[model samples]
Target chain A: MKTNFRTAVLTVLIGAGTVCSAVAQDATTILQKMDEVMYSQKDMTGKNKIILIDKAGKQEIREATIQQKGTDKRMFRFTAPASQAGIAFLSLPGDVMYMYLPAFGRERRIASSAKNQNFAGTDFSYEDMESVPFSQKYTPKLIKTETDAFVLELTPKVRSDFSKVTVSIHKEHFYPILMEYYDRGGNKVKEAKYTFKKIGNYWNPAEIEMTDLKKGHTTKMQMTDVKYDTGLSDDAFTVRALVQ
Target chain B: MKAKITVLLFSIFVAISGKISAQEENNIKLSGELLTDQRLLLRDNNDWAWNENRLTLKLDKQISSESKFYSEIWLRNIGLPNAVHSSSLYNKGIIDPYNLEIREAYLQINGFLNKKIDLTLGRQQIVWGTADKLNPTDNLNPYDLEDILDFGRKRGSDAINLQYYFNYDFSVQGVFIPFFQPANMPVGIFADLLNPSIAMPQGMVLNNFSDTLMMPKYNLGESSTVGLRFKGFAKGVDFSLSYVWGYDGLPYSSKNMLTPVNMNGETNIQSELSFMRNHIIGVDLATSIGGAGVWAEAAAFIPDQDMVMTTDLSALYPGSPEPVTQDSVLLKKNKPYIKFVIGGDYFFADGSYLNLQYLHGFVHERGSEGLNDYFFLRYEKTFFNEKLKITPIGGGFIVTDWGDINENYAIAYLPEISYKATPNAEITLSAAIFDGKGDHLFASLKDYNMLMLKMKYSF
Candidate 1:
């Protein structure tokens, strides 16, 4: 009787393990699908309007032109707020980044370790501006499922400022609606909310708001004149083009 | 002639602006800034050092898919004019301390001959090197020291720059400047004190002193400058090798004369100053290691001739029974001397930055023996969502003679705070403090401690 009981318990435990494994696989698949949905375009160009709101409700606006090729190359050139005009940032594969200041008339290489620093006084960090896919940078596990969304906890595959990130993804479209970022000490530090609009065949992020929990600051980025698959050449993503 | 040139340039800009406004394509873009900078001396008797108001305008237009034009102009009122004679401003209309400057006006053509060639014509700033403000390889333009506080500023040069690209990661650039322009020295009391002093014998006192600056002739082979650079990126590092054949922007004392002593036991001295010719070979590299950005730049200057000052002292000793004697001092040997800078910068998680550099020579320092070692450091932190920044520590330490550091060392401190009043405006308050016991560069500036306030708005 004891042997039979032990066998039955073992079978039940094995069955639970299999279910957990399947759930994990499902979470990864969902994350990949979400990445594909966001980065499926061959290239994209748009004008970005960024508004910074302080704790006292003071707002400052800045504008830039953003261009991206594939999922690993992106460029941002400031066009508004005359003080910051002609400042540019280029991000390439393998965590490489370069910054150009018009006053200096030269491009400077930004270190990978500085990824956690704020980008141009905005709430978004350099890591947040990278054109990398979420599925490639993070490993996701299903935490729970709501009525219309799936909650997943993502742990970084490499060294990162955040210990983990929790994202709420749409059930039908696989697009992320909200994300909460936690610091290395496991404290929630930032929150980002996204609003996506279907542009032709692709789901484009029309607007995004990132809030710094510690600083009591929020940055709102609104995209305008968004164009996808415009056939931007690889030359546009190089350092030579960055200075221009 | 000067007024004619100014009017002509102004008319050209006005015509261009009018044409651009009439065009419907909207290809031309305009931007500008207005700034007011005031400074006060922090000495026994506090006095105003500078009260400057400036307006700058920039215009950019796309002429074609592969060509573009750009121009920048500055209109400034820097206190009262220095002219003491009414005749100096006779024909110059509305000369109320106003000056017009054409900072840059250039046309760029890409894919000139092939897909790899590009050319830029007219006046432009050709900045070189990977370091920040202190670049040893940046010599194409003359130094603009009109405002001593604005260090490392340079005047634009009229040149033709051609670049040929071997690939996306590599390129070669050549620049030819048709004329030489001398650096603008500081005005007012600083200029007076910076003049070289002559030492005389006990019995002979200085009665009169005169000096003349001899500029090179306008011939192409004598006064023109040329430069070449090869730039490339490899293994996550950007590097460049450059060469410049030019004349030094600063003049040196080349000849001197001591007049015969009069009955009052006084003598007169005359000096001639001229620019020195040099060939500079430079190399610069920029890369990142871990979390820090690192850069290094070095330039080897090879002078065409030995720098010697010949002083004819025969007249001073009229009763001497010997042949006419002359004194010769070798200021610099005809050999290669190097200037280099190595630096690194890092950003911390708390929104603070630290930059450090070790410089082997200052801008005015020349020759191996005259060069001094310096270490520059800057630390800044931002608050209030980066709207306000405080640079608590920003300065340089000069070691004039490493062997006698205790007596030959100097220190300068620049503490500053700036606030972004708006997205397009900023207000800054800063102070410059200097102290030293030796005869280093900072020692001369010790008495010029100052407090500065600057307000700038851009549109």
Candidate 2:
């Protein structure tokens, strides 16, 4: 009819370009299946009750609890009111300890001098409370693959502390949707946006924004009654449950 | 003092008339400033044009919700004319016109319990250290380098303060100066050395307080003060600690004869003393890393309760005759006197931020018998984008550790330039290089070099 419809449209565009080049050449198994579907429905490893809100919208509700036991152990725990209950913020993979209160009852160990302060005076800072160990500090770069997302450009392979991280994953679910922070005069103060919603089989992020380019401030965290793998422990995230 | 100013204006007018019948809200603040200086120091010496003007008026009112009622009034050196006359007897008078009184008035209170306690009782200005020219243990207030070379004026105190906090780190403060008003009083060392016709006599009643300005030529006793402060911060480290106690020294002697018919004029001895007893103690520390930052401090003053004795009121006024004695042990040469500072700051890799410092002062023995042994060096930097700023301040007063004013040496070299223009306007250019030798040539005028230009507008 028209040369058999131009050879069946070039054989369905070469079979959708070999299935998108086999999922972009296995980029670390598509980023570990996007961190197991972004921690498949909670229980992503014990404890968390953070509330950091600042930019003059002042508010710091904390009851920390985190213990992530895979992808390199991490721990943090800070109880409440009675003056920073016990306080503990550790990271094991090249040191980072911040023990707590010791005007007497012992527990002192905060030195590396201010890891970049600002975690209660909020606006993140404390190196933005860990969680970015992207294979020894970034260097990621995938660039593109639209339709569901997957665009990375991390940089910063050694300054020993973030100077670049531009993630944006999704691609059928590996959730990350945004992260920008740069300052060493590289400008770009801060940014963190996420807004996934899928419920079962996970994609988390039901709302999270944290902008602050030189203080114009912004902070929004909405998760309203979430429940994922509810089974936290490890002495409820230690330091004696943040000083009991 | 008028019953401590009517018990501090009746506790701030009954806490602003009981917070206006309990609607609880009150605040009335007003700030003031008016300064001028024009000194073209002899380039061609046309009678050395000198200019100075000052005007300050401040008022603050905020009753209930933790009191506050303040005042600061001044109108000095306006277009000169206080019957001009100054060239030593000690030099300070000339602010005539009935003494235009009242320099500061105070009252303050804060969060009784909830907000973590605080209370201030009138006439205040207490600044503690971070060294900018050796603040020898920063004793409440005391600084008047001829009003910073004719009107860059800055000095404060009139105290009663109490503070306490249990959060935001930690704090504890206390300052009291029941009576210690010393600032341009008795006309700064009695017009620099008496002789207002020998302390008034020909139609006395000099200014208000008439009756010859309430005679009583010289007597500065009955003084009191107390202080305590503590501060804290965790994780990012920060610290401060202080202690002070008041009333030190008491002495007055004035006698003169400056040749009332060839009996010699160089013998007008005057002495008004207060030999230390205003306890003091201090400590400070700061820390930071990851861009670097550090600070340090130290203070001591206990001996005769901390010494700072200065003499030679024309040689000890009131009928002088050999009276500047001591074979040591004038209370063992009163001790204390120790001030120190160490600094650090760095953050340059194209972001600008470099602050280096070093300061020291240690001349116990009454600053080795009247002032000396103080050194300071400061450097500040920031360029372009930060809107240009450069500061190079250096200070001195080694004078071979005093002692007969040991070949006296007083040096100052300030070079500041600022240009903010916007962000509330700013234009500054400071130049100074005052070097006075030998007991600072009886207090300055030996190699003077001063130039200043400042314009600041902020809203």
User: Against the true two-chain complex, what DockQ does each candidate achieve?
Assistant: 0.71, 0.03
For candidate 2, report its TM-score.
Answer: 0.30
DockQ, 0 to 1 scale, candidate 1: 0.71
Q: Give the clashing residue pairs of candidate 1, or none.
A: none
Candidate 1, residues B195-227, lDDT tens digits: the string is 555788678889888889999999999999999
Model 2 regions lying over 4 Å from their true place: A1-81, A85-124, A127-142, A145-150, A156-160, A169-244, B1-8, B16-127, B131-159, B162-176, B179-221, B226-290, B294-326, B329-338, B345-459
C-alpha displacement of B214 in model 2, angstroms? 29
Candidate 2 per-residue lDDT over residues A1-244, each given as its tens digit: 7988888887778877876565555554666566566543424443445555544655545455555534333466554432344356644333334354421221222334345444543455555555544534565657676787877656777674446666777776677787787775677777888887876555556666777666556555545345555564433332222321
Model 1: per-residue Cα lDDT at residue A196: 93
For all candidates in order, the CA lDDT equals 0.87, 0.51
| Candidate 2, backbone clash total | 28
> Distance (Å) between predicted and true CA of B363, model 1?
0.5
Please write out the lDDT profile of model 2 over residues B302-344, one tens digit for every residue: 5533222233333224465655432213333345555566766
